[model samples]
Target: MQKHIYILLTILSAGVLMGCEGYLDQKPRKSLVVPETLDDLQALLDNAVIMNSNVPGLGLLASDDVFMEEAGWAGLFAEMEQQTYLWRRDGGFEVIGEWNGAYQKVFYSNVVLERLHEMEEVVSANERGRWMALKGAALFFRGSAFYDLVRIFAQAYQPGVNDSEMGIPLKLTARVTERPGRATLEETYKQIIGDLNQAIEFLPVTASSLNRPNKPVAESLLADLHLQLGNYSMARDLSSSLLQAGTLLDFNELNPEDPFPVPFLNSEVLFQSVMAVYSFTFSSLVQVNPILQASYAANDLRGRIFLNRQNPQVVTFKGSYCGNFDYFAGISLNELYLINSEARIRTGDVAGGMEVLNTLLEKRFEAGTFQPLEASSVATALAFVLMERRKELLFRPSRWYDLRRLNNDSEYATTLVREMGGNTYILAPGDNRYVFPIPQVEVDQGMKQNP
Candidate 1:
C-alpha cells in the first residue's frame, strides 16, 4: 500500500508541477494512472502528508499568541514569513505554500469525488458503505480546505454585508480547464456548509483512523463554522451533541517536564492534523506573549504543561496536541467544549455555559486545585469563556479565526500590537490588512486579488 501511494503521489506531483500559468490550472497528464478502485481512492486520502497535514500556517504566524524579538524577526529566512508576522500588505506573498497546499487538498478531494461519481451506478451492494465513506471523506476535505482558505484570504463574513464580498475561488471539480473566478463570501460559506452537511450523513459514526473524517468530525467542523458565522444556537446544539460522548485527557496524567505533554492522537482528539512547517515557528527568538503566559495561574497545570519557561520573559509554547514540535491544527474535545461553552453563553444559557467551561477547566488544572468558575451575569460568563478559549487553544489556527469573528463584536474587539527594534505595529479591528492578498501567480492568471 505504501509503494502504491508513492507511485500515485509521483504521478500527481508531476501533473501539478507541469503547469505554471495559475495555481489551480495544472492539468493532470493524460497518460497518468487514474485512481479507479475503492482501495485506490482510499489510499489517496490516506496519504496523510498531503491530505491531513499541510493546513495553512500563515494564520498561526499572524495570530497574536506568539511574538518574536527584533533579532528573531531579522533572523527569519523567508521574507514572506517576516512580512506575514508583521501583517504587511505592500506586496504579494512570493511563497504561497499556504495557499497552494490548501488547494492541493481540494484537488485531491475533487479527484476522489469525480471518480466516485463515475463509479456510483455500478457499486456493488457489499461496497455501498465504503463508497459512501469515500465520498463523505472527500467532501469533508474539500469543505475543510475551503473554510481554512476563507478564514485566511477573505474578509470576515458579515451576515448581510458579505453577500458581495470576494471570497476564495470555489473549485468543485477536478478539471483544470474550469478556471472559476472567486465566489462571493455568501456563496463560499454556502458551499462549505452544504458539503459538510452531506459529509455528516454519509460518513460513519467513527473513522478508521484519527486522520480520517467521521460523522463526529464533520459535525464538529460544521459547528465551528457556524460559530464563526455567529449561528450560536446551531453551534451549541452540534457541540453539545458531540460532548455527550467526548472525553478529555486529564492534565494530571501528563508530566509537565516532558517536551510534549499531550500525546499525539490522544483520546481527546477527534481528528489529527499538523500545520505547515515554518522556520519562524521553531525560531529560538520567538516567545509566548508575556501577558498570555501570565494569565495562567501558578496552580493551573496547563501553565506548566502548555509552556516552557526559559526565563521570566522568554517563555515558549511546548504543549501541542500533535505531541511534538509541530503545532496541532486538529479538532479535539477541548475545542468543542470551549465552542459549546461560548455558544451557550452567547445564546443566553449562562449557567449551563459556566458549567461546561468549569468541567473542561477542572481537567486542565492540577487535579484538586481547580475551583468552579462563577459569573454574575452573561457578560461576565462570556468574558471568562473567551479568555479560556484563547488560553486553551494557544498556537492553533483557532486564535486567528477567533480574532476575525470576535472583531465584529464591539465588546470583544481587540487591537493587536507588536514591537520590534524601536518600532511598533498595530493591527486595528476590521483593518483591510486582515484579508491576505491572493498569491500574485494566481492574480497573474486573472483571479481577483484581495484589497
Candidate 2:
C-alpha cells in the first residue's frame, strides 16, 4: 500500500514539474492505483514523511537569528544557500527544495480531498466520523502549505492597502492541467481562513498523534494567523481559550549536557513538523547570533539548555524541540503563550499580558532565582513580550514572518545586516527582496516573478 502511494505521489510530482499539462495524459499502469477507499486516503495523509516534514527552511535561512562565519559561508555546499543567506534579488537561482516540498504537500492534500469528496456521497453512518476527520485533515494540511508559501513567496499582507498584491497560486483540485494563476493576497488569506474555520468544525478535539491536525491545532494556527494579521483581539481570545490545554516544560528538569535537551513530541508541542535540512544548519562553523545569545540572563536556564558552547568564543544552537538535529518548525504551547501575551498587550491589557508572560518565563528560569517580570505601560509590556518571543522561538521558521509583519510598524521595524568576507549586506525593512523571487522554473512556465 505504501509503495502504491509513493508511485502516485511520484506521478503527481512529475506532472507538476512537467509544465502542469500532458503529463497526466500518460496511460495508467497497473502499479498506479487511484485512492478510492477511506483507508487508502487515510494512509496517504498518514505518510508523515511526505505530509508533515520538510517544510520550507528558506525563511529561517533569511532571518537574522543565526549567522555563519567567513569560513562557514565559503564552505556552504550549495550556491542557493549562500544566495538565500545574502538575500539576493536576482532570479538566477534554480528551483529549491522549499518551493518543491511545499507544493508536494499541496498536491498530497488535493489528492486526499478529491478522493474524500467522491467517497462522501456513499459514506455509511458508521464511517461518517472517519470521513469528516479525513476531510478536516486535508483542509488543514492544504491551508498550512498555502500559508507557508505566501509568507515566503509573496509580500507581507497589509490589511487594507496591499490586499491586491500577488499571492501564491491556490491549487484546489487534483487536476494538474488546470493552471490557476496567482491569487490576490486577500483571496489567499480568505481561502486559508475559510479552510481552517471549516476544519475546526469538523475535526475532533484531539488527534491520535501529534503529527495529525485536530480542533486545537486548527484553532491555534488560526490564532497565529490572526496575530500575524495584527488582529490582536481575535488572537487574544483564541489563544486565551486554548491556554488550559497547554503544558510548558520546565528547563530546570532538563539536562543541559545532552546534545538535544528538548525531547521530541514533548508536552509543549501541539504539532510536529521539521524544517527542510540545509548543510549550514548543522555545520560547525555556523553560530547563534551574538546579540541573541547575550539576551539571556545568568539565571535563565534556557540560555544554558538552548545553547551549546563550543568554546569561550563560540555558541551553536542545540535546543531543537525535535530533540535531535532536525530543526522543529511546528506550533507549540510556548509560541501560543507568547502570542497571547503580545495580543493582550497590544489590545490594552498590559497587566494581563505581563501576567501571561511571567507564567511562561517562570518555567524558563532557574526556580529559586527567577522573578516575575512587570511593566508599567503598554510600550514597556510589549517590549518585554517581544523580547521573550525572540528568545523563546529562536531558530524556528517563524522569525521571517515575524520580521515581515513587524517591519510594517515604524516602531518595530528592523534592518538586517550580514558581513562575510569583508563585505556587508543590508536588508532594509520593507525591502522588495524580502519577498523571494518565485523559482525561475515556475517563472518560465508563465508564473509572474517578484521584482
Candidate 3:
C-alpha cells in the first residue's frame, strides 16, 4: 500500500477530526480543535511532495538517465562514478534534487509522525506498527540525508574534533513555522545518530533488505557511524549483529537470461521498491559505468547485472530495468554483513572477521577459491578489508560514505581531489565545495550554508 493510504486510514479512523465540534469543520488531524479555512489537511498532504529520492530527473543527471536532448544524466555524477571525487557548490540545479527531496520528505514524515497518535483507535495493531515504522524510517532517512549532505557539503569528519566545524542544520518535526540555524558539526552528527539509533529501536526488524531502512538498517548505519568515529570495537559488534541476523542475497542464483527480474533478483532484499504509494526511487536511470564494465570479469555475477556494449566498449547500467521498478526499495543484508566483517577485521579480529567475510564471498565466487585471512597485524587486515569493500559493494550507495572516511589521508585526498577536479579546481581541506551548498531558498530564509 502507498504510505499515504496508510496515513489516511490512520487519520480517518481517528475521527480524522475531533468530535463534538461544528459539523462544517474539516481537519484530517483533529489534534487542533481550532477553526480552519480548509477541510481536511489531506490537501496539504496531497500537495506535499514528500520525495522518495532522486526525483527521476535528478537521478538521471546524477547517474545515466537520458531525458534531455543535450545531456544524458552522464556528466553530473560523472566524477563520483569514476572515483574522480566530485562536489557541488552553490546548490545548483545539479543538487537541488537532493536538497528538495530531503527537506520535503522530512516535512512529510513530520506531518505523519506529529499526527499519527491523534488518529482513531480502530487502526490495526500491525497497521499501527507499520505506520510508526514508516514515521521512524522517514526520520532515519532525513537524518541520513542531512548526514550525507553535511559529510560531503562540509569538512570530512576528524576524530576528537572541535564543534565549530560546518554541519547541516537539523530540521525535525516538519517546518510548520520557523527555520533552524545550522547545528554544530557535533550537534548535527548527534541528531543523525540519535534519529538512526531511535529508528533502530522502533522500526520493524526487517524494513528493506536492499534499499530502505529497518532495524538491521539502523544497526548497519550505527556500525558505519561508530566506524567513522573510530569506535572500532563498537562498530565491529554492530557489524557482527547485523550480519548474523540479516539474510544474504545469493548472487550465485542468477538466471542468465533475466538477471534483474522479480523474486526481486536478490534474496537479501527485505522489501522492493513500490511506486503506487509512498513513492520515489526506482532503478529508472542506471547505465553501467564504463569503469564498472571494464572492471568486472566475464564470469563475475556483476557483469551479468550490468550492460556491456557501449559503442565499441562493453559497458552497461541497469539494462532494460533502467526506468522500471515497482516496489519499495530493497535493502541488502548481504552487503551489510560483509561490511560488518570488514569492520571486525579492522578491529583486530582477523580470524573472526575473515570467517564472516569468507562465508559471504565463498558463495559469491566460484567453488573452492575463498581465501581465509590470517593477519599479522591490524594494518594489513584493514587494508585487505578496504579492498574487499570496494570489490564487493560496486554500485551500492555505501561507497560514497566509504570515500568520505578514506578521503582524509592527505595523499589519498589529494589524489582524489586532483582526479575529479583536475588542476584548476583543486579541493582544499577546508573548502566549501567539498560539501554541497544548502539550497538557495533555505539560505534566503536564513539557513547557514556551509562555508
Candidate 4:
C-alpha cells in the first residue's frame, strides 16, 4: 500500500523539480489515475503521504531555541543537517527534503482542488457538502504549505518592500506545464489569507480526529499569520474567538518523571503533525539552550515538560508531543492563547493581555504558588508576552518565525551569534542571510533565487 502511495506521489512531484515551462508537456502515463470520484479527491487530502508528515524541520535547526554540544556538532553525519545547524545559506541544505516535501504537499493539494469542480456532475446532491469540506481541506493544506515555504525561503516580510520582495511561487493550478515565477511578498500573503479565509468558511466546526483540519484550525493559522504580519488587531480578535473552543493542559496533572512529559495527542493539541526527525541534531546530542532554560521560573512546569536533565548541567529535550523522537510542529490551543495575549499587549490592551497570559501560566506553574503577572505599561506587557511565548512554544518550529518578525522591530530585534570551533558567526537583524537561498535544483532549473 505504501509503495503504491509512493508511486502516486512520484507522479505528482515530477513537475515540481522542473521549470514550469514545458512541465505538462510530458506524455501521459497509463498507471496514474486522474482523480474523478469524490473518494479519489478525498483520498488525495487523506493520503498521509503528502498531508500528515514531512513539513520542514529547518526552522528548528536554525532556531536559537535548540543547540548542540561540540561533539554533537562535530558528529553530524548528514551534510544538510550540519550546514543547517551552522546557519549556512548554502543550497546543500535542500537535501534534507523539506523543499521537495513541502512543494509536493502543495502539488497534492492543487490536484485535489482542481478535480473537485469536475466531480459535481457525477456526485449526489447530499454528498456535495462533504465534497465542499474536502475542497476546503485542500485549500487549508495548500495555504499551510505555502505558509511554511514562504517563511523559510523568502526574506522576512517588510511593509516597505511589500510589492518587490520575492515570495515563494504561488502554484494555484495543478497543470504540470504551468510556468509560474516567484510572487511578490504582498501577493503571496494575499493568496494565503484568501485561502485560509475561504477554508474557515467551508470547514466543519468539529473534526473527527486531530489529523484533520477543522474551523478552529483555520482560525488558528490566520491568527498566527496575523501576529507574524504585525496585524495585532486582527490576530487578537481571531485568537480570542477560538478561546471558546481552545483548552490549555494543566501541567500539574502530568508526571514530570515520565520519559515523555507531554503524551501523544494531548488535549491541548488542535492539530497533529510532526516535523521530520533529525536525530543527529535533535534527540542524539542537541542540548536545550541555556538561556532558554534559564528563562523558566523556578515554579514553572514547562521547564520540566520541555527539558529533561541528563545530569545537573546537561539537559536534553524530551517534550516532543510525538511521545519520542520527532518534534511536534502542529497548532494547539495553547499557541492560540499566546497569540491572543501578544496581540492584545501589542495593541494597548495591557491589562487584558496580562490576564490572558496569566490564565495559561497558572496552568503551567506550581498550583498554589502561581502568582499573576503584573504589567505596569504596555511595553512591559508586550515584553512579558514575548518571553512567555518563547517559553511556551519552544522547539515547536515557531521561534525562527518569531526572530524574523521581531527583527523588523527595533524594540524587539535580536542578533543571533554562534561560536563554533573558535570562530564566531553572527546573523544580524535585516541580514540577507535571514532569507534562505533557493534550493540548488530550483536555481539550476531557472527559478529566481533569493539574494
Candidate 5:
C-alpha cells in the first residue's frame, strides 16, 4: 500500500512539475485536467508530494551548523554536495530542490485558487465550509511556497531597499503563459502576507492532521514572516499567543539513550514536514559541528536526546521529528518559545524574555540539575536566548533563514567559514553569495539571475 501511494505521489508530482509551463501557457494537455470540481482542487493540495513541507535542501547542505571531516568529505560527499560545502558558484550551483519543489506546489496552488471561484455556484451551503477551507489551504500553500523561494533566491528583505530590490516572479494566476517578471521584495512580501491573512480567516481552527494548515499554522507562519521583516512587536504578540495554547515535548519524559529519541508527530510539532534526505543528515560522514555540540551544557537533554556520538568527534543528528533520517523543518512549539523570547528581549521586556527562555530551558535540562536563568539586562537575556536558540534548533531549516535575517544586525551577524581541501572559504555578512544565483536554466530563459 505504501509503495502504491509512493508511486501515485510520484506521478502526481511529475504531473505538476512537467505541466507547470504548459499549464501556465493555457495549452491543452492530454495528461492534465483543469480542476473542475472542488474535490479535484482539494485533491491537488492533499497530495503531500507537492504540499508536504520542504526547505532548500542545498541550504542545509551549505549551512555552517554541520561539517564533514576531510576523510569523510572525500569518501562520502557527492559532486553537488561538495561544491555547496565549498560555496563554489561556477557549475552545479543551482539550488534546484527548493526552486523546483516550491514552484511545483505553487502551480498546484494557483490551479486550486483559480478553480475555487468556479465551484462557488455548485458548492451547496453544507459544502461551503469545505470549499472555503480548500481555498484557504491553497492560498496558504501558495504563500508559503513564495516565502520559501524568496528567502533562497533573493537578497534579505531590507525595508528601505526592498522596493527596488529584485524578487522571485510572482505567479498569481494558473495561466501557463503568464510570463511575469520578478516583483520587488516589498511587493513579494506584501502578496505573501495578504494571502496568509486571508487564509487565516477561512481555515479551520484545527486540522485533523498535521499534514494540512490550520489557523494556528497560518498564524505561526505569519509570526515568522513578521520576524524576518524585523517586526519584533508583531512577532512577539503572535508567538506569545501561540505559546499560550501550544504543547512542548518535555525532555525529561524522553529516553536519552534511544537511538531516535523523539517520536514522529511529537507534541512540540505544530506542523510536520521534512526536507528530502540526500545523505546530508543521515550519513555517518556528516556530523554536527564540534563547537556547536560543546555549546550545550552537560545536563541539557537536547544534545543527548538529539545526537548520536559514534566516537569522540563524530556526532550525527538523530532527533528528527520525522522518526527517520529526514531533517524536520516545520514549525513547532519550542521554536515559538524562542521566537517570542527573542522578540520580548528586542522590545525591552528583559524580565519577561528571561522568564520565557527559562521556562523552555528548564524543560530541556535535567531535573534537579537545572538552574533558572536570570539576566540582569536585556542584552544579556537576548544573548542567552539567541545562543540557546542556536543550540536547540541545529539541523532544522531555521538556521539558514535565521542567519540571513540576523546578518542585517551586526550584533547577530555571522561570517561562515569552511575549511576543506586545505582551503578556507569565508562568507561574510551581506555578501552577494548569501543570495543564491537563480537556476541557470531559468536565467537562460531570460529570468534575471542574482548578482
Candidate 6:
C-alpha cells in the first residue's frame, strides 16, 4: 500500500517536471503531473510519508558514518563510529536515502500548496477538514525534516542563542526562486509549533485508517519538540494527554508467528507507516549493542526481543531475530502513552509517570511481573524515562533524535554506537558532519547549507 503511493508521487511530480532541483531523478520511473484536487494531494502526501516500503529483501545496507567500516552496496568502503549514520551524516547511503525521501516529499508539498488555491470551489465541510489535515501533514513533514537538519547539521537546541546557531535552510513558503537564508533555531522551531497546533486543531483524531497521520500525530510531534528544547513540563503534559486517550495494540494478543519485538504498533502509536522485515544479509548489519543487551534484566519482557543467535556474544533482539519476523510499522497509541509517562516524570510528577510506565511494562513483562521505578533523582528519573523510551522504541527510527538530544548533555550522551572492524572512527561537529549536510546540489542553488 505504501509503495503504491510513491508510484503515484512520481507520476504527480514528473508530470509537472523540472520545477524542483531533484525532480527529474526520482527512482522507480514515475510520470509527474499536477494535482487538481484534494484527493490528489492526499494521495501524494500518503506516499511521501511511506515511500518504497515493504519488500524485505532490500534491506538497508546504509552504514553508520562514525561507527562501523562496512562494504556498502553502493560499493563504498566506509566505517561508522559513535554519532554516525552514513545515509544521514555522510550524504552517501543512509543519510542520502532519507534526505532524498524528505526533499521529494517537500517538493510534493510545495506543488500542492501552490495549486491548492486554484481549486477554491472544492472546499466543503469534509473537504475543508481534509485540506487542513493535508496541509498540517505537509508542514509536519517539512518541519520534521528541517528540525532534523538543524539538530544533526547544526548545534543542540539552546533557546536564546538560536540566531547564532547554524540551522538548516528554513524553506518557509516553497517558491522556486526563493533564496531563503537559514532561519535561527528559535524561528524555525516556532514555525514548527505553529504548523503543528494548526494541524492538531484541523486534523481529526482518527486517521483514514491505522497508517496515516492525524491529530495525535501532530501532538506527538509537539511533545517531541518540547522534549528537545528541555521544556520538560510542557513535554510531560502534552505527551501524557495524548497517551491516556489513545488505544494500543496489546502485545499479549500478538500472533505467535508474528515477531514484533518492539510493540510500536499499539493504539498508542499516533500514526504508523509500515512494519516490514528484509533479507538475511541485511539482518546481519543490525544487532543490539552489548550496552542495551546487558541492560535488560531477566524479568523484563523486552529481553525476549533481543536473541543470542546461537552464541552468547552474538545477540539480536526480536525485531532483528530473523527475516521472517521483521515487521516495520511506525508510531501508534502505545508510544504516545510512553511519551506521556516520560513527560509525567519530567514534570516532577514522579508518581504519575511511574504509574504510566508500570502500566505499560506490566503488559510487556510476563503476566504479573513488573518493576516500579522510584525516580528519586531528577537526573536518574530523566535517565530512566529515556531508557524506557529507548527500550520501547527500539529500531523504530527515532533513536537518532534521542541521541542528538543526549549529545548536548553528558548524562545522556552515548559513546556507544554500531561498531565494526578495528573500533576507530570520526564525526565532525567542527563541520557539522554528524548532522546532515545540505545536499551539495541544494547548497549550490542559493539555500544556505548548514555549517
Best candidate, lDDT: 1
Task: List model 5 lDDT by residue over 298-320, tens digit each.
Answer: 89988898878767678888888
* Candidate 4 lDDT score at position 134: 90
TM-score of 2: 0.94
Best by TM-score: 1
Off by over 4 Å in 1: 1-7, 11-21
User: 1-451, model 1: which lDDT tens digit per residue?
Assistant: 1112112453346234323445586655555566769998998899898888878888778889977788888989888888888888655455467677788888889888888888899999999999999999999999999999998889999879777899889999776777789999999999999999999989999877999999999999999998999999999999999995457889999999998888888889999988888887788777888888889998888899988885666788999998889989988999999999999999999999999999999998877888999997999999999999889998898888899989998998999998877878899999987888777778888888877
lDDT of 3 by residue, 306-415 (tens): 34343343233342222234322234566666667767876667877777766776665544544565566666766666756655554444555555566665533422
Assess candidate 4 and give its lDDT.
0.79
Query: Which 10-residue window of candidate 4 scores lowest in summed lDDT?
Result: 1-10
Candidate numbers sorted by TM-score from highest down: 1, 2, 5, 4, 6, 3
lDDT of 4 at 438: 69
The predicted structure with the larger TM-score, 2 or 6, is: 2
lDDT of 4 by residue, 1-451 (tens): 1112212333444454333422222333457766656776766677775687877777777779877777878877676777777778555455426666677777778777766766656768899788878978988999999899898888878666565788988878766566578898998999999999999998999987788899999999999999999888999999999986756789999888998888888888898887866655454577888999888888998888888876756778888777777788888888888999999988888999999999999999999999899998988898898999888887878898999989988999998888888888888888877777766666767788777
Number of backbone collisions per candidate = 0, 0, 34, 2, 6, 52
Model 5 ranges with Cα > 4 A deviation: 1-29
Which of the two, 1 or 3, has more lDDT? 1
Q: Name the lDDT of candidate 1.
A: 0.86
Worst 10 residues of 2 by lDDT: 20-29
Candidate 2 error regions (>4 Å): 1-30
TM-scores of all candidate predictions against the true structure:
0.95, 0.94, 0.69, 0.92, 0.93, 0.77
